[model samples]
Target chain A: MRGADILRFSVHALKGYPVRSVLMLVAMAIGVAAVVLLTALGEGARRYVTGQFASLGSHLLIILPGRSETTGAHPPILGETPRDLTLDDAFALLRSARIRRVAPVALGSAPASWGRRERETTVIGSTADFQRIRHLKLAQGRFLPEIDPRKAAAVCVLGAAVRAELFGPEAALGRWVRLGDRRFRVVGVLAPQGQSIGLDLDEVAIVPVASAQALFDSPSLFRVLAEARSREDLSRAAADSRDIIRDRHEGEEDVTVITQDAVIATLDRIFGALTLTVAGIAGVSLVVAGILIMNVMLVAISERREEIGLLKALGAASGKIQLLFLAEAGLLSLTGALLGLGLGLLGVWAGRELYPALSLAPPAWATAGALAVGVGAGVLFGVLPARRAARLDPVQALSGR
Target chain B: MIRLQAIQRKFVVGDQTVYALNGVSLEVEHGEYLSIMGPSGSGKSTLLNIIGLLDHPTSGQYWLAGKDVTGLADEERAEIRREKIGFVFQLFHLVARLTAAGNVELPLTLAGLPRPEREERVRELLAAYGLTARARHLPGQLSGGERQRVAIARATVTRPEILLADEPTGNLDRSSGREIIELLESLNRQGLTLLLVTHDPQLGRRAARQVQMRDGRISGDGRGG
Candidate 1:
């Protein structure tokens, strides 16, 4: 028989038992929906984390202290320790044309006291470009003034929690706060914000590089944050920054330069594996659905014993009969897959509405794979039942013996 | 035309072998109308199944329309059945979901006839069988006589040379059964070879030739009834 005819006949057969058909459909639908919704969730987590990294600026590079103990590098001898990253080294990154902006950061913990209210807070010392490079916004007043790196301008920016603790809603932008016996006037208050990586921006105190270096009594800078002219310039700028910093440190390539894209790529790889893993877990349910189809088809063989006998007597080849049975299974699973896709997309939409921050949607491969597994499982499981039906003894089947 | 020479069909029941057809031999000519009548367990139905190629004889030589069909494979036998044989069963055996027209067109559909040709054939058969108005009615909705008529229409729609009827009227009322018998006889008169297997002596006697079976073998053969 033609494929269309076989489909028509199988559809008629399925329609004869509505409850059975719908039961298999529901089972298959749930299996596919699990794959779609779960993979979307997995993929959403990946995008969210990568998005956090992207917010830090895709073109930014962090120059940290000390060389990583990578193979084929000059061994770190006891007396030849990697030098501290100084303010001069941070400034030298600007020597490269590929480098756009640089921020020299120095971190230290200090007790800040204003009139009797005392709090321990982290002090971040950096240049004026730190505001743009770190994407920090000011809630009130302006950030530190642009000045020479050697000038010890005693000005500070308080985080939201620090502002609330010391100022208590009062006007304190021009007031002087004492940090480690050094008094500095408040220049800005950072807006309340979530933590970035490990830094709690809402509780940090920002000050000038020279003032922080003097207050901490350390000549070493924490890390150098630099931006490339564009995303394409990041690699060259890193190489150039390494070369320029090495020239300053007496030809020692002692610092580790980490690009934002590398971190994002690593995170993306982890989350992509996570998405596929979750999809693999959900794929188990598809096989269960296929078993349901096979079970129901086995039952159908008995129930339609007379019909099968009639078809055999009517001269349908065994292959055609098997095809008819497989067609029914394929139809059931295909319909269920489509229904599950709609249901899953609706779920993904609802998830987006509930958590607007996460970008929730099914991955293309998961969508295709879920559909393939659903249908493939149905057809594969159908083989045994279809073969059983095809090989039925026509005489016995007709006699119902 | 059909010929069976020393056909033997054996059944193994646990520790014993029961012969369903013990070396029965029969010959049927083209356009012949014949019936095999016997009591239950007389192997008449088994004989009919072997002749229809639905069951294989354990040891036999058979010829159908002058072609040796005994050694044909399952697929080739099915091809022959599709091309040259039609069947009418006791229960009508219509797919309940199909309308009368759909049931009648099943043979042509299995034959893979094009839609226009198949539909025309179904329409003509339905009209001839006086089932034109009931074409869209399901088997459950039709009367017993109408359903049996529909079954006959399905059987002959493919225009096969041989028609095998296994108690085709057994499930119908006497009046409907009589109508069905008349219908089969009319097709037989139109040069289609008909083979009927039945328990009804009256129906069996209506055929031009009649055979009786006992103990898995033909006990009587008579004509001119």
Candidate 2:
């Protein structure tokens, strides 16, 4: 048949029973929607995770004590754990030509006070490089400097939430604060940096590394946080940092030199499995939808038996009859796919709008796969009914006695 | 021209085999007006279906235009039916969805004629059959005679060499039946072979030749008019 004739015939066939055609399209739409939603969920989760990592700082890398501790052979967050990294390792990496900037960090929970207000807050001790490496926005005075490292100046940077809680409607910068009986000057207040890994960045205090070491009274450096010049040199920079730390530890090979790429890969592996699990469950629903489509097509064939016979008697070839029914199935599925895609995208947009934390985008592969699957589903479900219609004996059909 | 030799058609009723047409031999010449008369079980319609190439005999040599159509496949038989013959049935078999003009235009459409020419031919044929006034009416809206006229127009629209009618008047009143038969005979006079099937002898006698069947076999063949 000519394309126009086939289209006309298919349209007539669909219009012949409006309710049935709508029902078929709805069934297909549901299947397509399921696929779209599933893909969006996986994509949304991935985006959320990646966004969190990027917010922490894209150029960042963390230098932990060792692979043995991170690999779960020992308690990583325990206070009794010994540090294989030292201040010398931090200095060497900072002096390296391939590296951008490095900061020595000493993290410990302590009681810090601003004026008459006192609250338990996480105290992070680092030099000026910490602000750039960790993407901190200064809401007030400047961050601590590397030049004043050994001066033991009583300077503290208050987080936004801490500033709000301690000194409402009052300037926090250049104010005197106390850290566990030690007097400090508050020189900066960071902008509101919301929760990362369930802990709010703006609820903490930043202090000089010398003051942190003095308060902790520890000779060992906990960890070194470093940033690379660019992503291209990340592996080489990581390897160089590892060699410096290993050499400082007398070739102990006890320190873990991890890069952003490594963490990103690990995060992807963890969530890729999760996304696959979701998709597999959704795949079951699709199979059920496929079965529903097949059953419906079969019913359609039986209902239109006389019409098929009439068409046959009208000199319609068996192939034409088969193609007509197949086209019906394909058209139904394609409509469903497009509608599902629209609904899925709308859902993603709505999710992003409603919940900024859940960042959502429709995955490229899933969108394309949904359409391809819909066409495949149409053919799969259509073939049996088309064959049944095509193979019907015109004589018996006409007689229908 | 159509011919049948030793045509046999059988059906299974439980375990018993019932022959609808058994060892039936018949011949119809070009432009011949013939009627097949029989009781319901005597295979008049079966014979018509076989002769129209709508059915294959269980065993026999059936020829249309000197070709042994019994040997032809279903698709080949359909091709011959499309090109050489047209059928009018007791039900009129006008596509319910199509208008009178569309019903008449179907065979031409199947023949792949251009749209303008198909429309022109359809209009001319509907006008010839006195259906121009009802050209846009559906089959359900037309009178029995008008419906039969539309059926005849549709059948003859392709200008087939032969026109076959199976109880074309069966659903119509006596006057409508007479008008349908007259219309068919006029087409026959115009050199289209006409074959009619009916149980009513009065209707059968109007044809130039009548063949009577009993128990799936032809019992008598005689001049009708």
Candidate 3:
């Protein structure tokens, strides 16, 4: 039979059994939709986290006081190093022409109180360059000044949540708040930044690095944030920071200097694998849907045996009959796949409306893969039924056996 | 033309080899109008099925239009069945899902006739069957006589050289059965070879030639009145 005729007749046969056709269609659609929606969710999470990391800073290197690379020995817990990464080591990194500026980081929790309101908040210490490189904008007042490394400036910056808790309705600039045993005047109130790279910036206090060292009674710094002068200077800045730390700490390379892109790339690799794993799990449903297609097709062949016989008696060859049934199966799959794509897109659209921060969109490859698998499964599972229909004895079929 | 030489069709009914056609030999010429009549289990339908290439004889040689069809492959047999033969059944066997016109167009569509030609052929055939007004009705909606007419129209739509009908009027009322018989006779008169299988003696005698079968063998072959 001609291709068009085969398709037309198969369509007629599917329409003849409305309930069965609809049931089969739903099975295939749900499978395809599961694959699409799940992949969208997985891919969306990867993009959200990777984007957060990318927005941390440009041409940046974060230096921490520990060796991240293993040396075939027992690793230290709580970042124990041979020597402390001091303020002098952080400033010495500026000697490299590739490095633009460095911000020494020291953090500890302390109670800040004003007029009976008190809350224990994380206290981050850095210099004037901290606000610029960390991208922290101020709602009021000014950041800390560029003072000598040993001199403790009795000034502090309040995070948005801390300001609300301590000075509620009252303006906080210049207000003195006690931390541990000493007091520091509030210099600025940071604008609200809800969350960035897993850190809650809205609930911390920023102070001069010297003050944080004295308030916490610790000499070792937590980290050093270094800025590279240009994109090409990034790798050189990291190497320069590592060399500076090694030179200052008894010639021991104790600190880990990590470029911003390396961190983002590591995170990207982890999340990319996670996305594929979830996509694979979702593909199982497509296999089940393929089996459903096979079952329904077998039943359809049995129900339409007389019709098959009639076509054979009308001079249709076995191959032609098989083509007719396979066309039916293929049509069912194509339509179901398209419907599933629309359903998944609609689901992602709804997800975006619910959580706009997460960019929930299916990747192009995911969409194409889902469609290809859906149709391919339907056709593959359809082969057995089509062959059975083709091999039916016309005489037996016509006799209604 | 059709020829069967000692065609033997055997069936294994629970380990017993039953000869459906013990040793049936028949020759039919083009445009001949004949009927094969017999009691039940006498293999009249089996013989017709063999001649129509619907079944292969177990141990025999058969020829159709100068081709050695007995040993031909299934594809070749299907080609002969599709191009040179048509069948009308006792139950009419019209596809219930299709309209009258669609049923009539089945053979032409299988033959790969273009849409325009298929539509034209179906329309003319329905008109000749006095069914143009009922072209859009499904088999379920048509009367028994109309359904049989639709079947006849479908059977001849490919312009096959031979028509094999098995108990064509077995399921119809007397008036509708008579109408169907006249329709088949008219097609036979138009130079299409017609082979009818029937248990009704009156219907069996209406053909110009008749063959009587008993125990899977032809007992009588004679020109009818």
Candidate whose lDDT is highest: 1
lDDT of 2 by residue, A111-201 (tens): 8776678898888777888888888888778888656655466788888988888888987777787777677788888888888644588
Summed backbone clashes in each candidate are 0, 1, 0
Please give the lDDT score at residue A216 for candidate 3: 94
lDDT of 1 by residue, B23-122 (tens): 9999999999999999999999999889888999999899998999998987888888888988899888899999999999998999999889999999
| Worst 10-residue lDDT window, candidate 3 chain A | A69-78
**Of the pair 1 and 3, which is ahead by DockQ?**
3
Residue A298 lDDT (model 1)? 98
Candidate 3 regions off by >4 Å? A70-83, A180-182
Sliding window of 10 residues with minimal summed lDDT for model 1 chain A: A70-79
Give the C-alpha miss distance for residue A150 in model 1, angstroms.
Answer: 6.3
Off by over 4 Å in 2: A44-48, A51-59, A68-89, A95-97, A110-120, A147-153, A175-184, A195-199, A210-222, A229-232, A265-288, A352-359, B140-145
DockQ class, candidate 2: acceptable
TM-score (all chains, Cα) for each model: 0.87, 0.89, 0.95
Tens digits of per-residue lDDT, candidate 3, B1-225, equal 888899899999897989989888889999999999999999999999999998989988899988889987777778888899999999888899899999999888888989999999999989988999999999999999999999999999988999999999999999999999999999999999999999988889988899999988899999974
Candidate 2 chain B worst ten-residue window by lDDT: B73-82
The top-ranked prediction according to DockQ is 3
Fraction of native Cα-Cα interface contacts (under 8 Å, chains A and B) also present in model 2: 0.22
